[model samples]
Target: MTWTAPEPTRVGEPLTGPERPMLQGWLDWHRRTLLTKCAGLTADQLKLAAVEPSNLTLLGLVRHMTDVERVWFRWRAAGDHTVGSPYNSADNPDGDFDDVATADAEADLARFEAACADADRAAATLDLDHEFATARGRRSLRWVYLHMIEEYARHNGHADLLRERIDGVTGA
Candidate 1:
């Protein structure tokens, strides 16, 4: 399925498609926005822990957001299809990045990218007005897409700081 969005990027710009405030437009914009937040960084820079007390690394955020996208869209929205086990286990809410070894960096990133791809594909085909029930109760796919946009937009702000602190680069 193809993306039906009208925007080129999620934030600070108009897009190159048929003009409309469609669901795909918002979701695609947000998707691009989230991915852009992670652009222009080395694997090491992405793993920076500059603030010590802060777990505010770009890589950490990627892993966490990937888990979030998976749970909300794939697991909950898709009605319990397996996309691997939940990243958050009984004793590990941060399991997404809990074992961030230098050796595993590539694999972890691949996982995140794959998750995003899966989400894009699902969203392209899934109905925006469809309802999905979860522990939080049923929600429209409209809610899910907007929620994802909110989730990534918020974290991308944090990513700007982490990236800037790492290398002084910033922007949407």
Candidate 2:
């Protein structure tokens, strides 16, 4: 049987909550929005570019976000600089977004999910005010949460357009 991206059960962001839960809720919502955009798409369709001269694809977005989750939450926020992107390297920095033509969409999606779960674990014991050093200087877990939500929200917008281009499906 042909593999297709599975639909994610997106939860509504909490209307009211503490700072951490509110941020986490929105981040999770955006993450699910990305997966929702890819639902029911076959590998080939997931690999389809948004348009010529642009390499964006649903599968590529999955891979890219997997790296983003790992980098910001697991690596930076959690202070595991040893963790590196699975789909990127100095020689091919854009691998996550550029290598989707033959990528396993199913596995990529699974990896994305795993990365998110790992990120959550990394942040679980930390305080929202927890701070870490980076080349850009110190950053707080709160900053990471805000940045991640913004990142996912921007990418999810691209995902919306890509999905629509692929199958004329639109909206959250």
- State every prediction's TM-score relative to the real structure: 0.77, 0.97
Among residues 3 or more apart in sequence or in different chains, the pairs in candidate 2 whose N, CA or C atoms overlap within 3 Å are none
Report lDDT (CA) for all predictions: 0.67, 0.91
Candidate 2 off by > 4 Å: none
TM-score of 2: 0.97
Q: What local lDDT does model 2 show for residue 133?
A: 91
lDDT of each residue in 100-155, candidate 2, tens digit only? 88788888999999999999999997999999998989999999999999998899
What value does the lDDT take at residue 38 in candidate 1?
Answer: 60
Pick out the ten consecutive residues of candidate 2 with the lowest summed lDDT.
50-59
lDDT of 1: 0.67
Using TM-score as the measure, the top candidate is: 2
